[model samples]
Target chain A: MIKKFTSALNLKSGHVDLSHGGGGRAMTQLIDELFIKHFDNDLLRQHNDQALFSVPAGRLAISTDGHVISPLFFPGGDIGSLAVHGTLNDVAMSGARPLYLAAGFILEEGLPLADLERIVISMAAASKAAGTPIVTGDTKVVERGKGDGVFITTTGVGIVPEGVNISGNRASPGCAILISGSIGDHGVAIMAGRENLQFETSIVSDSAALHGLVADLVAVAPAAIRCLRDPTRGGLATTLNELAKQSGVGMAIAEDRIPVKAQVKAACEILGLDPLYVANEGKLVCVCEASAAETLLAVMQQHPLGRDAAIIGEVIDDPHGFVQMATTFGGRRIVDWPVGEQLPRIC
Target chain B: MIKKFTSALNLKSGHVDLSHGGGGRAMTQLIDELFIKHFDNDLLRQHNDQALFSVPAGRLAISTDGHVISPLFFPGGDIGSLAVHGTLNDVAMSGARPLYLAAGFILEEGLPLADLERIVISMAAASKAAGTPIVTGDTKVVERGKGDGVFITTTGVGIVPEGVNISGNRASPGCAILISGSIGDHGVAIMAGRENLQFETSIVSDSAALHGLVADLVAVAPAAIRCLRDPTRGGLATTLNELAKQSGVGMAIAEDRIPVKAQVKAACEILGLDPLYVANEGKLVCVCEASAAETLLAVMQQHPLGRDAAIIGEVIDDPHGFVQMATTFGGRRIVDWPVGEQLPRIC
Candidate 1:
């Protein structure tokens, strides 16, 4: 049956029309040929509206993210990978190991089947690499001119391990802050692609699944870790501000220690954007006890995804709960949250 | 802080811009004054990327649905209620009691704040009424001309009680098929609103949450019920065909026994559309043992959402798995799945 449907689909040249998402034979064919073929799993084989499974006994963490990145395809990643990585990272930020994902796609009429297939393949690869299968999904099509190419919304569920309690409000005075790697790669890559901007060096998006890295960190120091956050949409500055406000603590970061690629810094300068506010898909900000900062940094630096991990700052006591950064030239300034978004649809 | 942010929002006159979904202060303001204000709960107040909660030990069912209904507002319900009901029904089809919902919104720039507020209020009301709180959500904005007004994708998680094993493939040769109520109201309401068509009587959508009704039916015949499906996008004909194929059996329906409202029938006739293929937001098709069919129908009819419930069909042994219907005109015909959607974006 699957072979018959696959043969009917002109995978190389056909385009998605209204019928592909019409909840009829065309829609079923597309799911069977494209989605089910790539994201095959036991639970999804049931072909039910929902997936039924057993969850381990523990606190569960569920997160949702909508990916509307334009151009669908980027240098190192596309909207598909970003959708999977973003939601999985969100679930990971809660100090949990992501278990499964549910994807919802809103496709525009007349989209090329080739492009959609590529995106689905990428999503399946990301899910497979992360060990989290996309167990269920729904698709809807809008008329031409009413929608962009494709907008994917992914929701993930994870199980929080015992003895692990992480939240934004767990940051406290004297806690050390660490960043996984250099930032601004993802934002700069997306901006360059959307605006057709060229640079000396092409900056690829840092989009990746971080659950494995997070698990490694938690294993080393579960009790010492205070909080874990992925600096995504609002970037490092806004993330720190949120943490400070939630924890009622001030933050002081040294600019020289924060990791930022030279090319990325140059690109942000050319675009007149602050790297502090640029998004990073594969980066994380870790808040932990000062005593465990060096050991945690060592463990993070050994991981492939966190080679450039650095201890960037420390928490402090301040009534205003301000996030201040020490400039490279010995100046200090408040790294406040941007009033408006510096980049929209970068994810 | 929340009060200060609320004062800053001109809720009556403001329009959403790209910044509102930019994950910055503007986005935070919108969330604080609008979404958080209405869907206020302790889990959301934590303001973490993911919500953490405890679930009972049992089989878990997770479902996702993307709602792209045209004309954000219709005669009976808006996109918000439809989003909630659609996801909840999908979970309930697995005989699960839905517990939590996660919403992700893709908003087009320049959408009126007032309209967004109304939609959010409706979602909150629906969630509250259904006893399912939307624990976490994400919002992203697309540039004007890149998206329609607003598209919402909701994912729900539920727990299936012990001794209940419901699936589409569980239907057997002797099972009887039942429908909850009149069909085609939702699709007709949407089509009329989009095309500016009028009828003698207003055709309002039957968009509603049916988990309570499903629970009532499940309680009466837990073991006797074979399968449950809500005829949403492809309506009764498509739904029956899907069930037949899944169960590897044939279905025979009496068209006259299927309930269709007078206004809905008239509207479909004028539009040259079939009621069997039109969408229904708040209806279900149940396949149960013949012995329990009468009892299930009685229980369903007592519920407000299923007052017009009727036994319309039965499953039969056939290798071909065809769905044949006895037409009102006394002719028998194969009720095949539509090749394409009759009404696009009808939810």
Candidate 2:
């Protein structure tokens, strides 16, 4: 079957055209040579519109996210890796073991075949490394000017272990707030890659899958961890505010305790942006019982992705749900959620 | 909590801006008043990055589709209904009853809030009518000119019944081929909606959810049904060719027996397009045992979505796997898979 369609695709020099998304012979050839060849699995090999499989009886977690960063190729990561890491982190935040993924691609006509292939290869590598397979997918094409290079929407599903109850509304007073690593790396990296930006830095996107670290944390303290969130689009400040509002509590943190790379701080200062509100692809905020803070901090520190982990703040009993920061000058100020995004298309 | 953010949104006069997708206060406000208000469910109300729920032990089917149809509105349907029906139909093609959906939206900046709300309402109505609730979702905003009006990607999960097997590769020689209703209406409607088309017709899109009809068919003849497919995208000819190749058999159908609306045919002729290669939204092609064809046909005809159901073809023993159609003028021609899509972005 593949032999009959291999001649239709010119992977070396061809560009995506209207026929590639026409749901005809060209589309089949593309799916066969590029997608199926890379994402080969028994379920996907069935050539059915949907993949069928059995699941164990347990709680399931589902998440979906769209990736449309301006620069397809960023400093530390590209849109492909970000798409997978973003959705997988969302599922893992629920203390679920990530299992399967479904991807949808919106490609602009006339995109280089080489670039598309590179993105798919990167996605396949990321999914394989994370132990999640993309089982089913769909592709659509628009006119040249109607779309950017490409946009990917990934949806993931995972199973939560019994007795594990993690949610955004589970935080309460006396809970300890901890961050996995330094913030502002991803947002600053994206900004540096933009054409108008004239800054140089070694800071790279913190776009790594956190399911492994999450699995380790859930193994040690399933009940102690109250909630988990990854600071993505609106960064740390927005995430904390959301948690505070959702849990109906307040947060107090010492500014000196939060970890921020010097380069990121310099970039933020120059750009007039707040590091607290910049995005981080691979960092997470964990709220756990105050008693388990030390143990979880040690556990996180042992992991490569969490070497810079820190216990930055604590939850408080306040009806107003204000997040306050104790400045280095020994004064307190409100860390309000920004009205709008300072950086657009930061992913 | 809602009172504090009520003043930020002016739905009647405002347009989507970068702030709405920035994951900031504006994003939260939009979500609270629009998405959460309409897609209100227990899982979504949790306000977590992911939705967690328990599922029964069984075989699960998952599918994803991207809808980027040009001209947000058409004759009978819009992008919202197409987004829901397309993915739901993909799941139903496996003889599964769809349970839940996850939606991801990429909104271009400057799009009217009213348009977004209307699309969301239509989507919610379709989901409710089909009994498939959207449990999780994410929104991203792109710069103006970087995207069309909006693109929606919907992912669905359904449960396949035990002891039932349906796949594209399950067709065998002597199997009966059945279609649910008329074809080409969707593609013609979209083409008519595009600019510079001077034709006038009352042909409305056949965009609908067909899971209810599929459920009735499965209940009556689960084991007898060999394969199922929805003739979307490249339409009936492409779908038939794909099934023939997958099942390693040949197909023989009479062109006169396959139902095509008079208006749709007239439009196709005027545009130099073949009705067999045009798209359909609310249709399905089923392959079943020759002995059980009558019973399944009766069951499908009783359903509202399948009043024009007909068995217009049969599988044959041919290694070449060719699909041959007998013309109304007493001639046989090879119904080859189209080399490219005749109508792009028709959904």
Candidate 3:
């Protein structure tokens, strides 16, 4: 009955009603036709409310993230893909190979069924690309106005290989700072698309999972890499400030060396915003030994996702724990923590 | 600096503002005075933006929850305690011993410092009660109108012991069903206290961490226990239906055997709600072998949190996955999965 309804139903254009989230025939059809169809995997095939699986040998790292981004569907990605990538990256940041994921959804009443299907399909695509299957999950509905369109919370489990020691607190003096690509694209894109804030030129969000890129870096420069961070909510400035406090160290960056697209810079200028503090979905900030800087850069550049990799700065010893950047015009100033949120729901 | 401001801040009768969520002097003051003071611990003592810790050997279970209740402070528990307890119980439901928690706060602009302090203190109290320390956390602020006062997200990690296999799919025919205590307290309390809903009777939410109760149960009835679940959002009826489907079995329950307070029954009757489908913050549903039912009930009844524990039903072989309840009047009817969300955002 469920298979028949889902197969014949127009999943994309339909809106969800009270019955969709009620755990009755409507919900069963939605799950069987939409969620189960897209998120198909061996573990999910068991049809159990909870998933059971074995882990690989080594130290394990676990991380969970909740996705409450407004406009659930965005240019580069939607809430579904972001949930998978955000959590997978968090677990991978610990130098772990992400093994599996569990997703929990809180759907607002009256959400479009088509939108839900789109998001779930995207999630399935991202998981397959990243080679991690979503093993278990839950779904519940909140009344309209009580919740945003949809909120997804994903939990990830992974195993770190032997002899790998990576932490935000591990950055030290003499470590070189490298960024995977241009920053602020995600923040600008979301802002422009959301508030209808326009720019002379259009830009897209940089939301992608960087675990594969991190794996490549670790395979070659494991010992040289002291720390890795995704410049997310607080963007580059906030992330660096966090790293400084974590390692009890200071940092010095050349503004000209940091990668920022001209369009994004222009958008920030027009909106009276700071690109340095903007969010980036796909980029990473790497802290590695100065000696292996070039080698690491070379490796990162070879990957399609890291073609714009650049040496943005270097670690420094400062008892005051400040992060300073030399301006492109040769003026120096402190790049402190953000005074307030740059974009409220950028994530 | 942060310590002084947090101590003086009153969460009750206060509103949030821009500075509270910002990372400026005011934000620092808020963190130092409120969050740091209530969440004092060695890991948090380091005062880094993120926390680092080590875990003991065993398979790990991780869960995360976001609390955005309408009223920040509610009867029996506030958002702060709910944030901690919700995630801790989620981890515990997997039969794991919860170890640590990480919290993230999203304070709206114009929120009072005192209100923040109260919530933080409550969070501290709940964490301490569960014997778990909040190791790391992040804070961000949004504009006043953009947010609904305050939102909290907590992530929890726990270690599962070896040789213990428990899941929703483990239910078998002839298995006995037991409930920890009374139900519908949380849902009814929230409803009565709601701004628009006015009711004469008073009820308190049963918000609590169940790790202690679980520890006692594990000590005596580990092997016989087939499934353990916390009836939160969809309440007992939804949870039972899920178990039946997952375990590929049927259930026979006694409506009179299920515990429901008079006030709760009245509230449900007036509102045309079913008490069985109402949420319970501090209750759990346990399914175990018939032989271990008495032992588990005795162990549960001895605990203060489980004083009203009772055997409500038994598992039966039925591929149709029906959950039938025999009423006090000797009539039997299907107690199916809920038709809709009885009370949204009850979690």
Candidate 4:
């Protein structure tokens, strides 16, 4: 931490009050003592509403994500770390190296100050670990009943290196689809935390920043890679559907080749949910040319974050643009978007 | 509207559900039918997770703001337009020309689809009026009780012209302080709307984008201007206090010279609020050299947003860095940050 100002927050046993967001001395104390204390960088210490920086010569990619995950503290990661990972991954999916991030927080009145500090500490840690700092941010407060404990919105700015082009529309009929790792870990962990379900084995959320892995992939096959996406919210099935629709192509995914942890599979079976539709925070789905599949998968597995990477699907020519999956049971089914009973606030 | 995908939304009677944020077909429909339809442009049509655009080679200023204002619809401005204007102004405060914006929305489940559409339309209009488009966005839905109706967080990026530098710590003793227009319009309007107070004259929010006026000011006195800030939540009093503390200087202002509309002043009197400490969304304070004061004021007054512009005060040397106001009654008093009863969610 830069330690621009000493801690003046009553973090031991204090709760957030209306005045803390009143834009008065109280708000200043909270920001200086808490936010600036943790996210202290030269850009943030200027104490301006905006942060100024330089952008390299290249196309700029901008992305944003709103995280309202329930159970602020989850198994493998909390909302704080999840917020950083989610937005960073979004920017990275564009084949751009995330440069900086800006966060907007809405805190519910009466939220414990200790909890807020913990979240900030964890968020700062995640940012530092990812090498992307939270440069500028805003804080707002709503009445106790009007908001949950905390909702974080992160916006990221990134720069694509020269000669790199990535877009959903870039995917064609003869592309191969690959995933970074196992699916449904993040969603299952949050579900277990919220339901207080005791599993035979611990299932942790796979919430990690993927920009480093994305950087490596871009270096190896910058031209062959067509589109990149993180299977979050509605998970892998929905992600493929989005790409298929955008590219005006259909997909043929083999279920047996898809990677899924044994623990996550068991949990989904017990909960009567489809792992294909459950969210994953750390993993990524890449649609690339046929020539890049083998090289990309090898390069991806070389990275620790993508050790279990697999080539699970391929793009096919179909006017309807459907995503069909060959199940392990020797049956084929159209993998459509999830409709009902979908989890909310699962990030 | 680009009309990429025609409106498939059940706008008359539908309510938002978890599926809208579930990364499923519903979410796509909501995004394409509403957000894309209104915010359609070449960049947004890419349908990628992130928006990629060319940025000029220059300094970049980035900012983020979370809008949780009560009464989603206010008299003069709603939360939608306010979200865009507030963030653009923040970037403009740094003497930058805003280029693009990214929005993240947190919507409460069970909220009316009609209301969401209305807000999005208004937000699109605001972005269009300012010539800054919403290039990228994300939406998340929380349970009904966990969130209010809706909260929008907007992040903006702008390019600063060469040789123009603005910062909070640049103010100095003997500097001139000027304001764009009347204060307290936004706060008073919100208070009246919330309290259901029937005043003789209706007070409307002064919520407008200030980048055009900022551009003019920068063109006229780029190097002479020390710092620029919009008096938003803590109003002008807290803003001056912030500048004083930041620049390591004190301020002496003439209360009689600060422009406050007669209707807003009356409304404040009835509400026992100090117009000086009330919020103004569209107004801004500029600190510049004494030599540039007259020219800057003349340039500002030529703009519609600064028709009521005035030179209110000047920086004074004080070791304690206190802000003192010369009251209309010919006595000086310390202008301190408001301590309590701050109208929450004033945005």
TM-score per candidate: 0.98, 0.98, 0.89, 0.97
**First chain TM-score, candidate 3:** 0.95
Q: Which digits, one per residue and each the tens of the lDDT, describe model 3 over residues B198-277?
A: 78777899999998898889889788888888887668988888788878898999999999999999998998888888
In the range B1-347, model 1's lDDT, one tens digit per residue, is 22224257887999989998888888888887888889888888788999998987778999999999989999899999999999999999999999999999999999999999999999999999999999999999999988888999999999998888899899899899999999999989888888566555588899999999989988888989889999988888888888887788999999999999998898888989999999999999999999999999999999999999999989999788888999989999998888668978888
By TM-score, is 2 or 3 better? 2
TM-score of chain B of 1: 0.97
Residue B9 local lDDT, model 2: 71
Worst 10 residues of 4 chain A by lDDT: A1-10
- CA RMSD of all predictions: 1.5, 1.2, 3.6, 2.2
| Residue A254 CA displacement from its true place in model 4, Å | 0.7
Local distance difference test scores for all models = 0.90, 0.91, 0.78, 0.91
DockQ of 1: 0.75
Model 4 TM: 0.97
Q: Considering the two chains of model 4, state its CAPRI-style docking category.
A: medium
CAPRI-style grade of the A/B interface in model 3: acceptable
lDDT of 4 at A337: 64
- lDDT by residue (A1-347, candidate 2, tens digit) is 42346365677788999898899988888888888888777777777889887898888899999999879988888988888999999999999999999999999998888888888888888999999998999989898988998999999999999878999898899999999999999999999999998688989999999999999899999999999999998889999999998999999988999999999999999999999999999999999999999999999999999999999999998898899999989999999988777889998
Return the lDDT, model 3, position A237: 91
Q: How far is A217's C-alpha from truth in model 3 (Å)?
A: 2.4
DockQ of all candidate complexes:
0.75, 0.81, 0.25, 0.62
